[model samples]
Target chain A: MLVARGVTVAIKGKTLLQDVDLSLSPGQVLAIVGPNGAGKSTLLKAMTGERKTTGGEIELDGRALWHWTTAALASRRAVLAQSTEVVFPFLVSEIVTLGIRRNLTAAEQYRLVQRALVAVDMSTMSDRVYGTLSGGEKQRVQLGRVLAQVWSHGCTYLMLDEPTSSLDLSHQLLILRLAREHALSGGGVLMILHDLNLASMAADEIVALKDGNRIASGAPVDVMTDDLIAALYGVRVQVRGVPDGPFLLPQTARLPG
Target chain B: MSAGGVAMPAGTGAASARRGGLMLAAGAVLLVAAIVAALAIGPIFIAPADILAILADAAHGIRPTEGIAMRDAVVVLDIRLPRTILTALVGATLAVAGAVLQGVFRNPLADPGLVGVSTGAAFAAVLWIVFGGMVGAFLPQAVLAFALPISAFLGSLISTVLLYSLATREGRTSVAMLLFAGIALGALAAAGTGLVIFVASDQQLREFTFWTLGSTGGASWFKIGIALPFFAALFVGSFWLARGLDALAIGEAEAFHLGVDTQWLKRLAIVLVAAGVGAAVAVAGVIGFVGLVVPHLLRLSAGPMHDRLLIGCALAGGALLLLSDIVARTVAVPAEVPIGVVTAIIGAPYFLYLVHRNRAALGG
Candidate 1:
């Protein structure tokens, strides 16, 4: 499990995130949803130990996050940043292979790379230079690299920031499903998402942030209410309850005069 | 699901790995050929067979009895051998330094000379040459012998530290800032060198000019002995740095997430580059292009994997430098074009081509 308690991040006298609390338990997918500048990415960075919280603490597997060495932490958790640009002409397979820090045998390493590529639907383009890939294709390859990091590490945490931002409709679904599968397999997944409908469909719990504060957090049914959505995003919306979860409809959105 | 239609080959990675291995082998062969040609094709024109025989006999502690054999022995062992070895060592050092800098800066244009490390070293060497008499009065004879290289090493180390700090902000390095700062640093060092030259006597001026043009002409066993440890330090450091450098290609934060100690890697690379390049400049002046051209060429052929790339740079860098030294020796006969001139004539155009090719990236 990964947990952040009362986390606050301030840079140069400006607060980016304040008093945000969240937890990702094994066998669960947690989604953080907010408008731009609502501290969604900041909260994720704090949770992943990429940014230090000005006032609070993050813990992983019941231990302080900073207590773990980088190598040990790498084996226990993986982070997929919002954007990654590879500066060399590294092949797709080589890019994926960079994520594997384990002392695996040659065959085992190759198998891991192939498995990750197949998981991300990038197996066919494994030999292509990474720099030449389309944006969505490159994002999938980066996802594969992250997946390869914790593929065999049981009980690992996968923290992704907008994993579907560059992905198409089908790939967005595919990636969310992969995250769900990871949770179902006794791992934890923390994702920052922009599409509330996708978050409703994929996440067991939804967290809403506004102006560096947590507006609401609960199972999708409780947190996806129209009133909360309007308050969080300042847009009128209808939330219809479904068997799976609540689906958001924003057809009547209007700006205030 | 048209996997059958794609005809995807198995182990594309393996194929590239094989290509890398072949490139390494080719580089090694080229280095050997260059060594033989450098030893045998000098003005004295020693035969290849006799050169080998002289080497073998020297290994067995034998000396030629008389005549042309003895003269050949003198030329090969005393004159050509040390020079050739020094050229190879300097080549390998500079190339490795360039490769490491490129990796650290995450730009192909990052070379020791281009980034001001060589100019900084040259400035220090000039300083020592122009003013050593006063300083030498206080130091022991043994320390005086090492003062120039030590000063040169400190100069490069300081310049690298400055460049790194200037270009990096909050742990992210800006390539544009790095290159611009390198140009500024190079100009500053050149200005300092100019000031030292202004105070130098005519004889000192000539010697400094020769040094600035770069040469392996003053090669001796003592000079090689002085440079060997620095060379060893560089190669050893590069071997240790290979994995970290490869990881660094994906950005510093990404490398950190992959468990690479990026700060330590950068510090070690800077130190090794200073030691290796400083020693090279101390013995052979300010040779250019070997560092820039050799590694870039090897990277194009052998892929950017650093373990193999470093080894390839060593071999190819040595070969390229040995060949360049040959051109320097024979180009105008006794007149002897400076090795730096030869490398610049070859390397500067390739550098411009690289800039042209990477213009889009550079713009960003």
Candidate 2:
């Protein structure tokens, strides 16, 4: 489990996230949704120890995040950043192999890399040059890398920052479904998502933020009402209950309705 | 699987390693051939068979007999042989340093020569050359012999630390800052070198200028011994750094997430670059482009895996330098042009071509 309490992040006296408190228990998928500059990514980075917090306590499995060695922390949590720029012509398999810890035997690492690539539907491109891949394919490869990192580490946390931002619809669903499966298999996933309807469908819980402050946090259906989302994004929106979950549509007026 | 076409894992596990091993083997053969050529083709040329015999005699403590002329033995053993070995060593050091620096800075254009590191070492070496008589008055003979190389190493070490600290912030190295700082440092070090030149006596000035032009013309057994330790450090460090550097090629943050200690890797790479460039500059002045071009050519052929790239750099760096040194020695005949000039003549155009090819990455 990952927990953040009283987390505040400020850079040059500008607060990016203020007193943000959240907990991600094992076997749960938590999606954070907010407009641009709302600090969703900042909060996630802080929790993952990528960004330092000004005032906060972040803990993983009862141990403080700051106190854990980087290697130890890495073993417990895998991060799939929004974009990882690789300028060199590394084979996709080589990139995925970076996430495999040294403790694993060569055969074990090979198997894990193959499995992770398969998880993201990139097993076929394992020998292809990573630089030549399309943006969405690159994101999937990074997903494969992270999946490989935590594949054997039980009760680990996966922190993803806008993992679906560049992905197409089906690929986006594929990623979230993989994250959902990760949670189902005794992991905790904290993902920053832009698509509210997808968030409603995939996330077991939702945390909505506006101007660096949490506006609502609960089960998706309880927190993703039309009025809440409209105020959160400063736009008029409609929420319709589908058979599975709530669907959100932005209400644009032809004239000043 | 839907539209992207699911296929079997192409499986890069053992094949790349096997290919890298083959490339390394080829590189080693090429280096040996270059060394033999370097030994055989100098002024007052000796046969390759006689050169091999001379080398075997030197290794086995046997006196040269029957077939070798005294003058030929002196020229081959005392002059060309040591010169070739030193050239090979310096070349390998600079190339490996260049490859490692490029990995550390995450830029293909980063080289010890281009970044003022060689200039810094040269500056200190020139200072010692000018003032050694005065300083040598007090020091022991053995210490006096080593003073110049030690000063050169110190100079390179200091500059590397300063350059790295200046460009790094919050555990992140700014590539633009590093490049600009390198320019500023190069200019400053060059100005200092000029100041040393202004105060130099006529003979001191000549020596200083010749060193600046760069050569293995001064190669001696002592010079070769002085450079060996730094070369060893660089070779071993490059091997140790292969995995971390491979991880870093993606990005520092990503490498850290992959369980690499990025800070330690940066510090280690900087130290190794300093030692390698410093020692090479001490022994052979400043031979350019072996560092810049060799690794890049190898990268194009062998891919960017540093485990292979570094080894490839060692082999190819030696061969390229031997070739350049050959041109430097033979192209000008008895005048014996500086190796630095030869490298620059070859390097500058190739560097421009690289810049043109990577124009978009450089924001040109």
| Reference-based lDDT, residue B136, model 1 | 89
Candidate 1: TM-score? 0.94
Q: How big is the positional error of residue B125 in model 2, measured in Å on the Cα after superposition?
A: 2.2
Interface RMSD, one decimal, each candidate: 6.3, 7.2
Fnat values, one per model, are 0.38, 0.47
Query: Weakest 10 consecutive residues, lDDT, candidate 2 chain B?
Result: B1-10
Please, what is the whole-model Cα lDDT of each candidate in the order they appear? 0.85, 0.83
TM-score of each: 0.94, 0.92
Candidate 1 RMSD to the correct structure: 3.6
User: What total of clashing residue pairs does each candidate reach?
Assistant: 0, 0
Instruction: Give, for candidate 2 chain A, the lowest lDDT window spanning 10 residues.
Output: A248-257
Instruction: Sort candidate 1 into its docking category.
Output: acceptable
| Residue pairs in clash, model 1 | none
The TM-scores of chain A alone, one per candidate, are 0.97, 0.95
Q: Alpha-carbon error at B146 in model 1, in Å?
A: 3.5
Residue-by-residue lDDT tens digits, candidate 2, A77-151: 999887788867777887888887766766677778889989888887887889899998999999888898888
